[model samples]
Target: MTKLIIQIPCYNEEATLGMTLAELPRQIPGIDQVEWLIVNDGSSDRTVEVALANGVDHVVSFARNQGLAHAFMAGLEACLKAGADIIVNTDADNQYCAADIPRLVEPILQGEADIVVGARPIRQIKHFSPIKKLLQGFGSWVVRLASKTNVVDAPSGFRAISREAALRLNVFNEYTYTLETIIQAGRQGMAIKSVPIRTNGYLRPSRLVKSIPSYVKRSLLTILRISMTYKPLRFFAVLGSIPFSMGFLLGVRWLVLFFLENGTRSRAPSLILAAILILIGFQLWMFGLVADLMAVNRKVLEDIQLRLRRAELNSNQKER
Candidate 1:
C-alpha cells in the first residue's frame, strides 16, 4: 500500500473541473486511498468551487495567475508535504484519463524508473490537428537532440514521479520546464519511461497554435540553458566546433591561394576574420570548462548539505 497523490493544475477550467474530479474516483478503484490535490492558478471562474464540490481533499489557490510551471510546482510541494510517496501530475481540463493512473505508477512502484510520462498518441485520435502533430514531432526531436534521451513526449502534462525525483526538481519558471526536467533527469542518470495514454476532446479550441513562435523561441532558450547548466562541456564543444571548423577551413583556403599565386600575400580580411572566429571559439570552449567545474562544485556542496540534513532528521527521530 504505497501512498500516492494525484495533482491537477487548473486555470479558469470551471466548465470541466467537476466532471474531471467525479470521473477520477470512478475510474480508479483505490481512489479512496489516494489524495487529490487541485491547484487553482488564479482562476477567474468557479474552478475552486467545482473542485471543492466534487470532494477534492486538498486545494491550493494563487491570488494571481502564475503559469503552468508555477501551478505544478505548488501542487508538487503540497503533495510532498502531505507525505506522498508517489506524485502524479495531470490536467484539470479532463484531457487525461484517470484509469491510466495505475499504468503510469507501475514503473515507480517497481523501482524501475524515477519518472514516468504518459504519452498520448495523437495519430490514434480522430480529428487530430496537423499543425499540432508537426509541432509535437519537432519538439520531440529537439528534446531528443538536446538531452540525448529517448523521450517521445517531453511536453506531455501527465506524469508520475517518485518522492525522490519530485524533491530533486526545482522548476522556477514556466514554458518548457517539463523538457528541462527530462534533460536534468537524463544528466543525473535517472531512469525515465513513457506510458501510452489518450487525450479527451478539448472543451474550447486551444490557443497553443497562436503562440508557436514564442514557444519555439522559449523552448530553444531553455534547452540551451539546461545544456549550459548540466552539460556545459557538450554544449560548448558543439557550438565551438562550428566556428572553429569554419575558421580553420578559411585559413587553409587562404594559405593554399597564397602559395599557388607564387608566394603572394594572403587575403588580409579573410585572415583577420579567421583569427577572430578561432579566438571566439577558443573562449567559448574555455568558458564551458570553467562552467563545468563550477557545476561540479555546486553539486558537491548540495550533496554535503543533503547528508547533514539526513543526519539531523535521524537525530530528531531518535529524540522523538
Candidate 2:
C-alpha cells in the first residue's frame, strides 16, 4: 500500500494551526492512507498542544528553535523512520492550498517523478508586490540554472518526495531547504517535476524572508554554496577563466609592447602583473580539481549513508 504523510514544520503558529490542519485532505486518489505530522521547532507557544488536539499522527519536537531548514530535515527524518512511502511538505501558515495536495503528488503517483514541486502563480498573486514578484521570478530562474532543471518555483515549500528521493536529499544550509534540495536532487539525476498549484491569501509576513535584500543576499549565497558543492569544476572553471583570460590578454599586450620596444625588459611591470594573475588563476583551477575530488568522496559517503538508513529502517519495521 502506498502511504503518504503530510508534514508541516511549525514554529509559534498557534493561531492558524487548526485551520491549516482542517484544510488538509484525509484521502486522495492512489494514496492508500493519509497521515499528518507536525515538526514543532521549539515553539514558545502551544504549537505542540495544538497539533495534538488537531489529531496530528506524529510530532517531531526540538528543544529550541533551530530554524526552518533544521525543522524540515528533522521532519523528513521522522517521516522516513515512521514508514512513510511518500512525504509531502507544507507550511504551517496555511499559505498553500491543501486541496492541491493531490496535484502535487500526481507526478510521483504516476511514477513519472521522484520529486514534485508546486509552482504558484506569482504574477497573479495579488498580495505579492511587483518587486517581490520580479525577484521571485528571477530567483527561480537562478535556481533553474544551478539545478539544471526547469523548476518554476524554487522557493515553494509545498512539494512531495518519494521514499527514494527522500533518502537521497541532504540539507547543508540552515537558512532553508527549498532551493538546496532542488539543486541536490537535480544534480543527483533524480526525476524532478513541477505542477501548477494554488495558494491562499496572505496570513502573515514570511518569517524566512525578513526583507527583499536579506532574501536576495541569503539566496545568492546559498546558490553559490550549492554550485560549489555540486559543480565545483564548472564553478571554479568559470571563476578562474575571468582572471586567466585577462592575464593572457595582458601578457599578449606586454609581449607586443616588448617587441615594439626592441625586446627590452625595462617595462617589466605589465609582465609581472600578468604572471601574478595567471598564477592566481591557475591556483583557483587547482582548488577546483581538489574540490571535485572531494565531491566524489562525498557521493561515496552519501551512498553508504543511504544503505545504513535502509538497514535501520528495515530493522525498525522488523521490530514492529
RMSD of each: 2.9, 1.0
Worst 10-residue stretch by lDDT in candidate 2? 263-272
Runs off by more than 4 Å, candidate 1:
26-32, 207-209, 301-320
Q: Model 1, residue 299: what's the lDDT?
A: 81
List per-prediction Cα lDDT, in the order shown: 0.80, 0.94
Cα error, residue 283 of model 2, in Å, equals: 0.2
TM-score of 1: 0.89
Error of 1 at 305 (Å): 6.6
Query: Residue-wise lDDT of candidate 2 within 72-121, one digit each (tens)?
Result: 99999999999999999999999999999999999998999999999999
State the lDDT at 258 in candidate 1.
83
The lDDT, on a scale of 0 to 1, for candidate 2 is 0.94
CA lDDT of 23 in candidate 1?
A: 69
State which candidate has the highest lDDT: 2
lDDT of 1 by residue, 1-320 (tens): 56688899888988888878876752334333687899998999999888888888899999999888788888877887776778999887787888788888888888899999998887665555677678777887888777677888888888999878876776644753688888888877778898898777766654333466777777788878887888888788888888988999988988898889966775899999999988888988998889888989978876785566446545654675
Clashing pairs in 2: none
| Residue 278 lDDT (model 2) | 91
